[model samples]
Target: MSLGAKVAAGETRFTVRSPHAAAVDVCLFDGTAETRLPMTRDGNDWTLAVPGDLSGTHYGYRASGDWAPERGRWFDPAKLLVDPYAIELDRRFAYDPRLSEYGADTADLVPRAVVQGALPVVPPAPPRFARGGLIYELNVRAFTMLHPDIPAAQRGTVAALAHPSVIAHLQKLHVSAVELMPITAWIDERHLPPLGLTNAWGYNPVAPMALDPRLCPGGVAELRETVAALHAAGIGVLLDLVLNHTGESDVHGPVLSLRGLDNAAYAHEPNGALINDTGCGNTLNFGHPAVRALALETLRHFVRHCGVDGFRFDLAPVLARGPGFDPAAPFFAELAADPRLADRVLIAEPWDIGPGGYQLGQFPANWLEWNDRFRDDVRRFWRGDVGVGLLATRLAGSADLFGPDCRSVNFLAAHDGFTLADCVAYEHRHNHANGEDNRDGHGENFSWNHGCEGPSHDPRVNAARAEDLRAMLGTLFASTGTVMLTAGDEFGRTQHGNNNAYCQDNAAFWLDWAGRDTALEDHVAALSAARAARRAEFAQFPQGGEWLAPSGAAMTVADWEDPASDGFDYHVGGARHFRIRRAERSAAI
Candidate 1:
């Protein structure tokens, strides 16, 4: 809240926090000209004030101090560093070798943060998304890139989401909230540009608050308007945020914002090497008060200014790690105590590639977690690798994982893995296009090819795949607790086995609206309607139920454990019944 350019009555105040810097300067840009104003140091903060409201003015910062990378100090005044609290940018970040060069002047390379005036704050309201509703996860750009109804100019931006066609599609599926993948500004990995690839997923963020100009050129107002429109249509908006790391990356990486202003913002080993908890070069030091403050302000900014219902944190374990992940971390306690964030829907992608990072069900009782176990076990079940017992356990809310409360967000597939359609059509990942020698995505996907790999022209193979797709969708809807369906999955979108399509910004990743499988979509719509009609039963684990065999008799222990057993009928409270037959590849409620 105390950082970045703030415009108030009759004047504008520029503030930045750089604890290790000897001095800091506010660089103002005007077309082809520039002016640098010295800021007075106040403790760890640098402050400057200019007469008149400087709203819409472009600005950046330069901090001068020790330039020791090995010792965790990277102070470079030549680099035009972005404001850590930047709310908007005039351009998108582009990766360049000069950005990482110590003495290179990057004023022409880095984006300038635009000074914003006072924004209209949305009135506080309870989130539209409920704990047990459907969350439709999507990549904003890829989701609408090929939509026929959206105007060409708006196809790949946030404003496109407000289109009538998009809303109608979401309504058809009974989506409670649309979990938009990262819309914040991000930079491509250093290795990507040369390979003619970009970060299609905005996970490699530098400025936490700034919205990417390419994605939302209208900035805060654009997002606020889209949120209002979705809310009007009975859908909530949940932003997927990456606060764990920045694109600044390792010591060999660039000196953008935090890295240039205050290297101490990143977690470092005792000997001064940067910690790689996020597998993204650097891990933010949440233990630092400044880092925590920036995170809280970022969340509040979205809720207060943009009216977003909640957030789903990427690599969430890093937020709890003060060197090691702690369920009782201060960040959790602080988040709960904050009046603005306390009641918001908080979901965690509860794992990272760090030490002791797999803390699946260890989040706060009030929080929900992404259940990869459900994803894997359910796939294994339909593939005939697991018996009915495992599938039943997942359908019953994975009490073994989440205890009695069932705080699981059960999903069949998400944006990071194979699509629901691809799961039935490809047994192996095809990620050669990622330039990683096909070793990028998960090798073992718990998938099957139905006697053929990739696309098969055989009618029988296609029929089998379609049936399996419906079976998985049925199982997801029948499972207890919250459920999420990745966009394009409900209608059979495929990436041709490219499980890791983060770098594929081409048509391969775009949803083919014209070619969608309507029959499968209709089946999903029916599944949604059925779940909604019995919302109470699906919202929680059944207190009492009858597990019946296909012959209309009670299921015995032998039936549950038998590998050959493939189907069961569950009757809940003598009112709601679920029928699932793996042999027939059919499930109905």
Candidate 2:
């Protein structure tokens, strides 16, 4: 019996792609009693006519095979498997070695969630706003965990997104979108377990189709309500999707959902063992037909079923990379043609931590990419790196990177790095607090800690830092790419230089709403509004922008500064804070 049909509430139908397992059994648990039902084989798919209706039944597949650790054949019949189509979860997973035959801790993991009804019926995905739309990237738990205004029950849940206080805040702020960090099911690393840290920025995805129950108070309904409310407020929701890899870490990793389903098909490999190209171990192989189908299925699931406006692919370069890393891989072409996904925003991280993997500005038309170059260039310039003398190109639109083909997802900071506050204040990564002895986060941050290493009492340094924040944030709003705002970076959120706060679910990652920085907040609100107005003006760019500089001739700093030069700038600049006028007339982009 296939897990999908079983979860649809009829007699369970099971299928397994593995021709290797000698025998397969579908075991059902009713809390008190356990029933073992043997499956009849048809090729590799086993048919089971289980007698019972299971709406919320707990189950696992028992395959006949030796528990051979050497050959990597781990078939434990005693272990209870989770329903991949389960609409509801049994309970929050705790990292425990007992969960698997091996003593590795896979607890804080996502129990295989179900697809509920077969084929997974979903509401139509809404239209995606343009590149100029504002995105508020945040952790669901941290967004409302400590808010005073959010109801106690709703705090830190998907319902918190629609809470009056949240709505009031986002609506008042005038942000066009909100990006939830890893709302998909995820698992925390074993080392983070003792520190009581969780997968705060959920890169470890357990189920691509299912929402992490931890983020929703009333499960799927609550998540649906949150999405609806955000739409009602005119805010589009973008999910941070980890399609480059899965929750399963390595061969030593646990037998999680995807690993158990189709190991060879779904993951990458070099010399037979799964390749850890994403640095998160077990990269999903989009090269495989079944894996590609799963990837397409996952996207369809979100677009049609989840009602999300778009997806931000984490480590997206791998998705485009094929047999090796090919920018124009069939995977991209397939998505580009998928009518269901064609309209929704497709934002890629554009690079993976692998050899020959960093592909920027290479994606097809209509896709938006996270421009790491923007972040690096902006940091280098603000830090007084004279090497960054050529930012006028980037500040203008990064046409060198994304060109006219695709728009860029530009920003100064993201969830995986130090917040803007830390970038200007701390010279090195401060991850000792992360329990990895300061060896966890990235050290090559291209950051310049102006006159201090962490927080300082010096007014000169602090004021300069504030100005730098404004400069970067200002540059982001001022640019032509799609700006993705890391949750509290607007108001000087600091991870104390802890770039990777995937764990540390506490205040380290959460937005401390009660403790507001009035001045920075106001400045951000104004800057964001200005950026938005300019974006609207330049919505249909090249089409809207008047030519300031000719294609062959170099645009100089003097021309940019000289107000007297008939040289008007195409950019509308900020609403009030700044303005630029171009000399010649050109079409909008």
lDDT (10s digit) by residue, model 1, range 1-589: 3788988879899999988898899999998588999999988899999999999999999999998888778898999999999999999999999999989999999999999999999999999988789999999999989999999999899999999999999999999999999999999999999999999999999999999998998899999999999999999999999999999998888889999888889999999888999989999999998888899999999999999999999999999999899999888999999998999999999999999999999999999999999999999989999898889899988999999898999999999989999999999999999998998989899999999999999999999999999889999999989999999998999999999999999897899999999999999999998898777778887678999988888999999999999789899777546888999998878
In candidate 1, which residue pairs clash? none
Positional deviation of 93 in candidate 2, in angstroms? 2.6
lDDT of 2 by residue, 105-196 (tens): 33233353332434334556556466677778888887788788888877878887887778877865677788887776667765567886
| TM-score of every model versus the real structure | 0.99, 0.87
Runs in model 2 lying further than 4 Å from the true structure: 1-3, 6-10, 51-53, 66-72, 83-87, 99-128, 266-270, 387-389, 540-589
Evaluate residue 220 in candidate 2 and report its C-alpha lDDT on the 0 to 100 scale.
66
TM-score of structure candidate 2: 0.87
Candidate 1 Cα outliers beyond 4 Å, as residue runs: none
Q: At residue 519, what lDDT does model 2 achieve?
A: 90
lDDT value for candidate 1? 0.93
